[model samples]
Target: MLSRRRFLKTAAASTLCLTAAPAILRAKNLNSRLQIAGIGCDGKGWSDIQEMSTHGMTDLVAFCDVDLARTEMVHSLSPSAPIFQDYRELFAKQGDKIDAVTISTPDHMHAIIAIEAMQRGKHVYCQKPLTHSVREARQLSNLATKSGVITRMGNQIHSHAVYRNAAKALQTGMIGKVKQVQSWCQSTGHGKSGFIDRPKTNAPIPKSLNWDLWLGVAPERPYGLQDVYHPFGWRDWQDFGNGALGDFGCHILDPVYTGLKITAAPISISAKSTGMNDEVWPAQMTVHYVLPGNDFTTDGNLEITWMDGGLRPSLQGTHIPPGTALPSSGSLVIGETGTLVIPHYAPHVLYPSPDAKANVEKFVAEPSLNHYHGWVDGCLSGQQPSDGFDYGGRLTEAVLLGNIAVRFPGQKLEWNADQLKVTNLEAANKWLSRDYRSGWKLPETV
Candidate 1:
């Protein structure tokens, strides 16, 4: 076993090598294995850790989770890997031992953890949307560029054959230049916890969980119950999550951005909701965005509409064969030649039988790549993958901007991406970033 002093020296040298050149050359190391840590040890985090472990070049080094009880699964996988309830402690003790981290924490903590990791020269594979706010997304993108570290967001479908094929089809102009798009999901914004407001009763925090750490960055609130705020229920809260648009937009709109090559942020945004209160997101909503057109677009700008809570676009003008139904969650792209339907994580379909058949014959499918292993490979080789923070931050910025629109229903908010603010509404600018609690504030510098 390598001594602590020698490990630190070697890790520092490896990190320097990674920053000095492109990742095509492998990092200097004891072996080919890339040391990795897993934060948030259950739910999506467990799956992420499990998949990454399958990569022969990756080695699990440590684990961290706010809830200790939820960490049994990971502990069972790597008995010798020490577990910590706080990520900061994990970094303090094992920073030199880790080469990369897989962050699958709640939405609010993603930016805070990812930024710190990158600043320390650690590669990151974070879950999407990359951050809770637009400003955080932009900050992450800028930091990733300056730090020169491998980074990838955990929208795994981006590597799947269906989405890869869809992106290629759109780029190849299989349906001609895109005119408009309609994307939606059947999920509601505030039902995960089955409460629209904070529960009147305060339940005792679990003995194995660190309540304070679980509420990191988010405003302090009473622990409602087991399924209220922790263990997959935070998605329904405004303080910790971004609601349906934030949950599904990064996923369903991924092909739209990839295929159309949309790098610029939306110019304007507006929204309407069924109803809402200060406590949680609205149950249903629709958001509209106007963005600058790229090479794959037909006109000056492309309009995209997003809906959730079972709301969908009217298929009146679409080329669908009259009585066909749209997917429960997916996107419909209207192009000059015909229409394309991209179902979430499923095969994409083209409208008009003749056009569909002709396009299908010419289309060659792209093979699915292992998203987890791809990040592991990138870390060892110093090569950043396609969904890295640079791309994910831009994609996440657009997704989170829709949430800002949700706050001001029926009002159009003009955006200036360069300024990272809403030009028309001064009040709306505050939503671009959030106020972190004391002691949990993000570093002002990279």
Candidate 2:
């Protein structure tokens, strides 16, 4: 078996030649199955693995997770596949056999694992937000382009009929030239872990868990009781996850980005929050983004407002009728002619009742494609999907930038995307990326 250092060196060398052709093209049979591995094998990870397994052209060869107790489901699905506590071990041992990897690990570990896998010419299907840091998102996208491999972000709803239709409607001028957008989710930033601060008492680590492995890139901290920092609780912490905006922004803002063709980075970002501490995110926050306008948007910078923690956009200007209620989580596209309300996972609605309703049928609704199967198909055919890292990275960058704005509540930080710098606040720029723990440091990127 290769040592971790040697594995990285080998992977780096392979990346140099990988740009010439995709790894999938090496299969003698063009129709041969893809040998796959699951880096995280429970919760959303299990669902992703289960769905990909049903694709018929993908085979699970290995499983890796920090906690052995949480891997029961993946083991039952692939009884013969070997399981490893550390993802590096699986990569080092089965590097040659694995054709692709599904990274359902916490937001913190996503970039490191995906970068290593892609460097080895392995396709990656990583969960959103694509990386914990904006810099990581940009670097990961650059590497994905350089490596020439199939890639997809695990924002599964991107394939849903509702979002597809919403995006199509905007492009088709159903709501002529969107003037502004308001998007929000009900999820809070720090409530999932049920703690506003780190636990004062340290609990003994479970034998089934590798606490060191679980902490991956974040600074070292003691393992607390169940649900404190393990399993599903990391979403509340600053180090391990991206809080509410990081968690749901990609899903909620996907259609807006797709519809507006927002390729340029936001020119400025300002935010306000209930409050925040060093360890956890605020419970409620609001961010404003000014992005360059496109053909789908009105001239001048297009404004987007984001809110969370039960904050909903006002319907006064949306023309949705005064008594009509908004969805708990969704976006409203304010346009010159009409407003489109897109509920998360539900059908979209248009305002100005009768007239807009008539045009709904004129807008084509795309058929919902199986997201997992789409990634597998992309791997086999070497055709990059619509939500590949290129698009995902840009979306994730904007989402994470909103989180950075959360730190300085009322300041409007001027963003220079080319330099990845916050021109107005040098201190804010520091939050763009983080200092990785000593042993988990990744190679420097441009």
Candidate with top lDDT is: 2
lDDT of 2 by residue, 1-446 (tens): 32456334333332121222124222221238988999898899999999999988888988887877677898888887877777776777787788899999999999888887877778999999999999999999998887788999999999999999889888888878888999999999987988999999988887677788889889999998888889988999999998899999999999999988889999999999999999998999999999999889888999999999899888877757888989999999999888899998898898853455336555656999899999999998888889999999999999999999988988999999999999989999889999999777664333
TM-score of 2: 0.92
Candidates' lDDT values, in order?
A: 0.84, 0.86
Q: How many backbone clashes does candidate 1 have?
A: 2
Clashes of each: 2, 0
lDDT by residue (1-446, candidate 1, tens digit) is 32446334323322111122112212233367888899999999999999998888878889888777777888777878877767776777787788889999999999888877877778889999999988888888998888778899999999999999989989988888889999999999987888899888888887666777888888888888778788877998999998888888999999989999988889999999998888788899899999999889986899999999999888877877767888999999988877989999899998853545345677788999999998888877777789999899999998888888888988999999888879989999988899997656775543
Task: Enumerate residue pairs that collide in model 2.
Answer: none
Instruction: Compute each candidate's TM-score over C-alphas.
Output: 0.92, 0.92
